[model samples]
Target chain A: MSERLNVSKTYKLYIGGAFPRSESGRSYTVNDAKGGFLANASRASRKDVRDAVVAARKAQPGWAARTPYNRGQILYRVAEMLQGRCGQFTDELRATGLSKSAATTEVEAAIDRWVWYAGWADKLAQVTGTANPVSGPFFNFSTPEPTGVVGIVAPDSPLLGLVSVLAPAIVTGNTTVLVASETAPLPAITLGEVLATSDLPGGVINILTGRRSELAPWLASHMDVNGLDLTGASGDLAVECEKAAAENLKRVLRPVEADQPTDWTAHPGITRMTTFLETKTVWHPVGV
Target chain B: MGDAVSVSTETLTGAAELRRFLHGLPGVDQVGAEERAARLATRSIKTSAKAYAIDLAISMVDLTTLEGADTPGKVRALCAKAAHPDPADASVPKVAAICVYSDLVAEAVRALEGTGVGVASVATAFPSGRAPLEAKLADTRRAVADGASEIDMVIDRGAFLSGDFQKVFEEIAAIKAECGEVHLKVILETGELVTYDNVRRASWLAMLAGADFIKTSTGKVSPAATLPVTLVMLEAVRDFRARTGRQVGVKPAGGIRTTKDAIKYLVLVNETAGPDWLSPEWFRLGASSVLNDLLMQRRKLTTGVYAGPDYFTLD
Candidate 1:
């Protein structure tokens, strides 16, 4: 398998290392902020959403089974790759309409946030969890785990919000199917390139670009999905998202109204490990 | 690097000329009506804020945060939440109406059926309000027909700044007619209006044209609502009450997040509108998080423990 080499085209969706077009056979262009066209992104359908879920389910056991130390190392490596490609992301952001200085700062913050999460992959369990001291002999400890497959509606305003939402989900363990902001989806799709190079197991993160009203419901109501984050949607769409998540008791994050600025410090650490955690209670026999 | 940068003598003069030309633009002297000042008084009328309560009619507008999921089930759940207040102290002011987008008005009205909460829809293009008047009117009519008790329309700040107050007034008056017995809240998008004087003038124009409540912003733009602008608006409301004796409400929406901010608004209302305007009828917070924080603080006061963000359900 290692010896054989072949040329490959890269304009395909990467899920579980198997590149495929959207099952819908549909593609749409992601435009720069100046209204110029960039590369085309596959408009994911309900079928692609299912395929991504399958890939994530397959990858979950092994990834979650890895020791925290190894997971942290891998995540750190991702931060390294992200740092190496900072200039590339900066250019994409600038092309997406952010001022040069804004783009640079955003790229740097995105990279730094990743590094922060990288350090967090191992430590989140301790910080966000607890060991209950009950009156029984059973030792019960609560550890945060991935919530399985996550569906994130990325903020319409790109850069900070995009990375802010995505990083928390994947760093813990729940794989994500993000509907990138329609107006600024290019930078998000480009992030997939960095994930691919960084040795992140495929399917841990899948980026889809399309109309929010079109694709979001499919992801929200999917039986396999465990959680939903509706940060970008406003007004009625937000209400629709809340209603959709209630179907399976999926954990929901409400939309942040326009007036409230994103408080970077109050960002949740819970996403890192809600899915994969099983909450086991162990007991030991004692002699008198 | 070899060539030294040089500025021509005429370039400096040209820059100065451009600045003077901009300052001399027509309608620059027009100050917007004091929407914030009027609202501050409304807060006082219900809360016993001091004096000036008789001149202002305080109307509370709510930006409902009940987001629905794609599933109609989720929609129903949100409907239930919207219909029921997240249980807490009933003593805090009762909102005048549950304000929402057109699509959710039906749900909001349905949820609020048995409750005293009337429904208000933020129509007429909303936040941006850049669409055609026909479109805006149609949106307003649809919301009203759909059971909205009030309409919050945004004045075309672009048109207003370009000295088209006639268009702005006509639009408000037209929407007011469509409203019939329903109320009207005209948003001036104060941040874009740019100055205290323009803000005061805009307030006067909206009230004179029949705005029941003059709101601050659409919550779409940054720096949307601020305290200083509110102060100027209160002064205008005081002046307007002195002139017309018609009590108008004020709504400063967008950026307000915490109890401290809410308290500051309450204080401003007491001082500006006096004690009479301080009630749920006159004062409201256009917020999603404020209710939660209020509930959390209320819980602490009652139970002596702080609740987690996830501790309470929307309903």
Candidate 2:
């Protein structure tokens, strides 16, 4: 028999729950490590980001309303799904520019990162909440609440960095509008597939693949988006998004260093998980 | 308090007359209306047009608070918001009106006393017209007496669906009588009507009975004020004007909660009803959340960036 034909996948942007082609109807060709043509990724437009924000805002209230234990279970499910699809992600990472060993390590680290944030989902409030020492006959307690919808810029390390950033935001019950890396988006999109199956509700994590410069500013200043993570953005791009985010006072996480790359395998702390959270304090009178 | 209604007597005499008049009106092609509304919805209104539309839509809003938990303070704040939607931006115009339940008309009037913004009240056993005719008229009379410049009255879906067309017609005419000079918006609650034919019939029925504006919903029912239904109402008004030479306005309330949704309705007016129905005098949106979106879009137009909801005042 003659050789069978390979049907390549049409990589589309993930917005809300569906994989829609960019509203702009544009795509960019992604090249493999040795400069071979991999596939065309959707060049997400500003409209796509706006739509993602709307979906994230819609899903946030319901997701945040869920019990913390359930949220943890959902996050763990995503990790389980990712671990099951480890070989596919490793191949995608290899195509993107990583060496074979590096690709496997990145995929494994990505799965571990999901598990890390999954545990934090149920522990975030207890570790961070505080009881205020008021002088009157009142009990004032302060605790963190999810800050509506978040916009995330997924970093260069497509698998690990993407998971590392997305896991923290959603673990705390905040829904996200994520812009995957411009050149390396396949792994992140594969993660989106894993998310779609892991009992995670649609719109909880809307992933878009495009040029960050074209898509980031809209999310940065989007009125409905409560927070923006620019951990993936560095140099002039980071500065531009930070400026735009000020228009709506979006809670932004700027890259710590101007040109430094975030080490995705490092042990991430409670910092990014709490970035998009608003601390609401409640006061109750002590009755006789 | 007396203004004559010039409805054609031949059509006003009986139920048979009203039914023939309503059914004789052109039937709405459900699929065609939905396709047209969807097409208009996709028309992109860009920067300059968006800014103009945001302000125009803001001016066309019937800023509403219809909850059971509503209070005087809430209505006052809503009225204040209607007068100045954005406290920081002075260039923005006030809203078209403050729509409240009849009980709070006085509070709305007191708050928006001299702002040139209108006060619209929902009466006639609103959200449902199950009350006795006299009680409903009393509700209308009380709202007008309390100083509502516009009255939004609900139709008894039971009466309409049960084919008692004259009862619905007479109820509207009676409320029109109590309205005095107040503009009357007849809510068809198209969600309950369920078909474009019924929505077309209800629009004609309301217009024939002297409704100054025909609204799509009471905002109390599900599937209220969909694009297709509103398009059918707009077509009815357009056709009515063509025949009677008297224009009526259209308001699509409920489920229209974004700047894009409001602009789509504007495009519906622009395309289906022409520019004559583009002003606050001719068109309205019965919504609350749409105002914030319009404000945010307006800010985006001015600053060349998108806006957050927290930057604007909440009512």
The DockQ value obtained for model 1 is 0.02
DockQ (Cα-based) for each candidate: 0.02, 0.64
Supply the DockQ value of model 2.
0.64
TM-score of chain B of 2: 0.96
lDDT of 1 at A263: 57
Candidate 1 lDDT: 0.67
Chain A (alone) TM-scores for all candidate structures: 0.85, 0.97
**Clash counts for all predictions:** 68, 2
Which candidate ranks first by DockQ, i.e. highest? 2
The parts of candidate 2 lying over 4 Å away from their true place are A1-3, A124-148, A246-251, A255-258, A274-288, B1-12
User: lDDT score, residue A275, model 1?
Assistant: 39
lDDT per residue as tens, model 1, B1-315: 011113221232342332332233233222333454444434422323311221111223364443333333443454444434344534443445666777777876776677676777889987788999999989999999989887889899998898766677778889999998888888889999877667877887787678887888877777867776766666566656665677777778888765446666666766777655566555555654555555544443454322333555553
* Displacement of the residue A62 alpha carbon in candidate 2, Å: 3.4
What is residue A247's positional error in candidate 1, in angstroms? Answer: 29
Could you tell me the lDDT of residue A223 within candidate 1?
55
